[model samples]
Target: MFNKWQAQRWWSENYDRIKELYNVQRLNRNAFALPTPPISEDEASS
Candidate 1:
């Protein structure tokens, strides 16, 4: 199929860039969902 071949060609040409972008997006998503560190003992004691 023409669409399939075109997709394949595009992927071959741009796979590395696509992968890099996907990785960056995934890292950003994970960073947003992650929690902050807990306060230290001195701060809690005060």
Candidate 2:
């Protein structure tokens, strides 16, 4: 369930609020923040 206008309003009010509430300011400050990619087994072993 997603409404385009509602989404816009949420972000328009203040983009920073999203980051502050999620507590990921240190990890990511982008307006469109995404989770870190998963590491493969080989990459993790190295």
RMSD of each: 7.0, 9.2
Q: Which stretches of candidate 2 lie over 4 Å from their true place?
A: 26-46
Q: After TM-score superposition, what is the CA distance of residue 29 in candidate 1 from its true location, in Å?
A: 23
Best by TM-score: 1
Best by lDDT: 1
Per-residue lDDT tens digits of candidate 1, residues 1-46? 5598899999899988988987844355566686878999999999
Clashes of each: 0, 0
**In candidate 1, how many Å is residue 27 off?**
16
Where in model 1 is the C-alpha error above 4 Å?
Answer: 24-46
What do the candidate models score in CA lDDT, each in turn? 0.81, 0.80
TM-score of each model, in listed order: 0.43, 0.32
